[model samples]
Target: MELKELLDIERQGWDALCASTGASFYGELMTDDAVMILANGMVLDRAGVVESLRDAPPWRAYEIDDPRLVDVGSDSKVLVYTGIAYRDGAEPAFRGIMSSTYVLTKAGWRLACYQQTQISQ
Candidate 1:
């Protein structure tokens, strides 16, 4: 898949976070066995992800920089980028290296895994 297409999907996820709709958004996007490996050292399964995001605070703003799409195989791809996320009343943004792996399925392109690495700066 083209970078733009996968990039759009990534942005849609960020937009979902900004709008505080990540619960439903991810619920639909993630595959049954998907997992989000957060920078905070939490590994969440699909159900955990949905529950965690259900009442999570929204991001005030976000930026995705230097994204690169990696071709893993015919039915799977990984999108990696540096992400900056802002929170209300927070002095500094949360910066991390974010990567999302998507797999094409009968349903559509669905998230297989998502990971975040904290950036020390």
Candidate 2:
């Protein structure tokens, strides 16, 4: 797939995380062996990540900023970006850089790995 298409999938996943909508769609966007590194440095597998998102607490908004393709191979790509998380009646709760890898599989582009590093104010 083209870079724009892959980035669109990435955006969809983030949007679902922020809106708490389309849980199944989010789950389907991930690979079976996907991995995620949280801002706290804890690592999680596909199921863990999906479950966490499904049960995430309400947030007012989320934004993926400055997303760019960092690397790309024949069937995979790495995206680097920063994200801001907003909560109701509060200042932005989290600002972090995120790196995610996506692989083109038979079903389409699926996230294979992700890492988030929190930026302290």
Candidate 3:
């Protein structure tokens, strides 16, 4: 697939995985060395992130808005956007804005790193 197509696929996978609240799908999309910086200031590796989410509350709903894609060439790109995630019985959590960088590898575009910051707006 072309670079843009690959990114689209990745975006779809991301949304689906979030909607499913399934760690396995998230695990599949992450590289072995992927790093995630959570809004709570926790830095987790691939396994750590997946394992933590496994026990977390299910995502009752989610919306990814205004996905902006930046091509870094050679099959690498960065996706920055704002998203809101709502869990059952909890108020909607607005992620404010976040950025996830993906690298195109033989295994397709695996997420390299993700950082999320809570927005007050």
In model 1, residue pairs whose N, Cα or C atoms come closer than 3 Å (at least 3 residues apart or on different chains), thus clashing, are none
Candidate with better lDDT, 2 vs 3: 2
lDDT of 2 by residue, 63-92 (tens): 878878866788888988888888777688
Tens-place lDDT digits, model 3, residues 1-121? 3545644754565565556655776688888899999888999998997888777656666677887877777777888778777767767855568787888788767888889999874
Q: Which candidate is the best by lDDT?
A: 1
Top TM-score prediction, candidate number? 1
Tell me how candidate 3 scores on lDDT.
0.74
- Listed in order, each prediction's TM-score against the native is 0.95, 0.87, 0.81
Between candidates 1 and 3, the lDDT winner = 1
Ranking by lDDT: 1, 2, 3
Q: What lDDT is reached at residue 79 by model 2?
A: 88
When 1 and 2 are scored with TM-score, the better candidate is: 1
What is the C-alpha local distance difference test score of candidate 1?
0.92
Over the stretch 65-119, how does candidate 1's per-residue lDDT look in tens digits?
Answer: 9999899999999999999999999844799999999998898789999999999
Off by over 4 Å in 2: none
TM-score of 3: 0.81
